[model samples]
Target: MLALRARRLFDGQEMRHDQVVIVKDGRIADVTADVATDVPAAVDLGDATLLPGLIDCHVHLAFDAGHDVVAMLEPPGLPDRMRQAARQHLAAGVTTVRDLGDRDYLALGLGLGLDGPEVLSAGPPITTPGGHCWFLGGEAAGEQGVRKAVRERAARGVHVIKMMVTGGEMTPGTHSHLLQYGLAELKAAADEAHAHGLPITGHVHCAQGIAHVLDAGFDSIEHCSFFTEDSYAVDHTVVAQLAAADVVVSLTVGVAPSPVPLPPRIQQRMAGMREALRAIQAAGVDFVIGTDAGIGPPKPHGVLPYGAEMLVENGYAPLDVLRAITSAAARVCRVGERKGRIAPGFDADLLAVAGDPLSDITALRRPLAVYRMGSRATGRVGQINQTAPTIG
Candidate 1:
């Protein structure tokens, strides 16, 4: 058994000071304020706070963050690039990531071993014929086609089903504000995924697409931006319906400052995007952050901290942000039992930062150390500040 003492602990829900977490055989054995003398050894993490390893609900390890990811999809050394990206996420303290889109089921074959984050893959997202991301090779035209697509993914061992209910800006011929599949096709996809005991998530935008997603009974919605033909709008009525239905909204969050210029359309509509996000928060909808990592330069695989920090900066409670990334995110990913909390009977995956995050949210940016499977894994990339070594 290994005992780790920390100044404070955020056990995925509440904060407690002067705690010791015990690990045995790669699982949390116990957590207590009083350290037991029976523990053979202890590692004292001075002046640091321990937190559950973070989970980013949406990522695409196959898409290296760059100016033109679509063009680079099938480039040389693609497998090597994916392995590197997964490790980058691990080094940033994200121990689990749900890959919402990938080509040829490459993420499942990465073979990064224990050092990489736990990957829950979607293989390839279900899209309409020649619709958004159809280039990824998941184009289904009719209701039967959508059902077949979901069954194929289930057979491929995908953890969840991802469907594009609307077009996306990333694809040249597709419009983000327009529906890609009608209600019947969507319902077929959802019913098929449910029959196989899987959750279905829809990529939707605009009020009409959101309503269609609800009508089809999808378990979760992604990128609920409420976009229109030429502008953006926050549909409070649809938002209320979503909240009333108790559906989870996986908000695509996070961006890094880059010298490379953003696309003109996105750059112009950023203000409106922020406004919609604020309104969504006010509606009190269930939410979890999905960094949509690896899509471009602004969304590198390690960008989850920036997303959490962004939410806290925008009038969100730090505790809520913490829960969103930890326990809440794990729940949405269907790994709630083993992945999120720092409690006994849970996986021994934890992150230690140099200071209390409740006071300054940026503390998460400075990970002093990371533990995975009861082992001291390395995470030496994030920003850090030194402090006197002391223990209570």
Candidate 2:
């Protein structure tokens, strides 16, 4: 067993000072304040805060985060690009990512290993023929068609089912305000997915679409932006309903510092989007951030830390934000049993930053060390000899 000592530890739920986490056979053996005498040695990380590695609930490894993401999909070496994207997330201390959309199920081939974060993919998101993301090839019409689509993805071993309930900004003919699938079709897809023991989430923008998904029994909603034809508005009633129903919202947030300007339409909606998010938080709706990384230049692969910072800036408590990205996200992704917590029997996927993130959320960007399943993936953690004294 390997003992990793850090000045502070956020064991998924809450913070504890001066803790030692023990790892054995790629899982956490124990986490205690007192170091055992028989333990071989402790890798003491000075002035660092240890946390369960962040999990991005929504991502698209197939997109290259370029000027023309759809065009980039047509090129060769797409799988290699996807792998590189996964590595960027891992290097940024995100140990798990759920690819909400990808082309040709490429995200599934990214094996769970130290090379990259553990990827839980939804293959190609189900959409209407010629609807949003139709280029990704997940197109079905009618209730029977939607059910067949869900069954196909489930048979392929996808962890979740993603359906386009509304149009998206990325697709030219599709409008974010318009619903893509009818209520009957949405219900069919949700029923088929749950019947196969998989959670189904919907890509929703307008308030109407959000309500439609909730009524259809979707487990979660993505990009709950509340977009209208000309602008966006947050419907408080729907927000209240979401909180009451206990539906998780995967808020699409995070924009990395970049010289390139945002797209004209998105640039105009920034202020409105912020206000909508504020309303969601105010209504006590459960939320986790999904950077929508790899969708544009501002959304590069490792933008989750920036997302945490954005939440803190917008009145979210650091402690709550931290849980949303770790334990809460794992539970939403249906991997809480193994991936999120820093307790005994959990995967030893830990991240140690240079300072306390609770006090300063930006500290997350300064990763001092990252461990993936008991193996050091990046950074140099300080190691002391067994004879030398170790920190708690």
Against the true structure, what is every candidate's RMSD? 5.7, 7.0
The stretch of ten residues in a row with the least summed lDDT in candidate 1 is 383-392
lDDT of 2: 0.89
C-alpha TM-scores of all predictions:
0.95, 0.95
Instruction: Give a tens-digit lDDT track for model 2, residues 79-187.
Output: 9989878888888899899999999898998764788899999999999889999999899999999999999999899999999999999998999999999899999
Candidate 1 vs. true structure, TM-score: 0.95
lDDT, candidates in the order shown: 0.86, 0.89
Candidate 1: the clashing residue pairs are none
Instruction: In angstroms, give how far residue 66 of model 2 lies from its true place.
Output: 1.1
Query: Could you tell me how far off, in angstroms, the CA of residue 242 lies in candidate 1 after the best superposition?
Result: 1.7
Q: Identify the leading candidate in terms of lDDT.
A: 2
- Candidate 2 residue runs with Cα over 4 Å from true position: 379-392
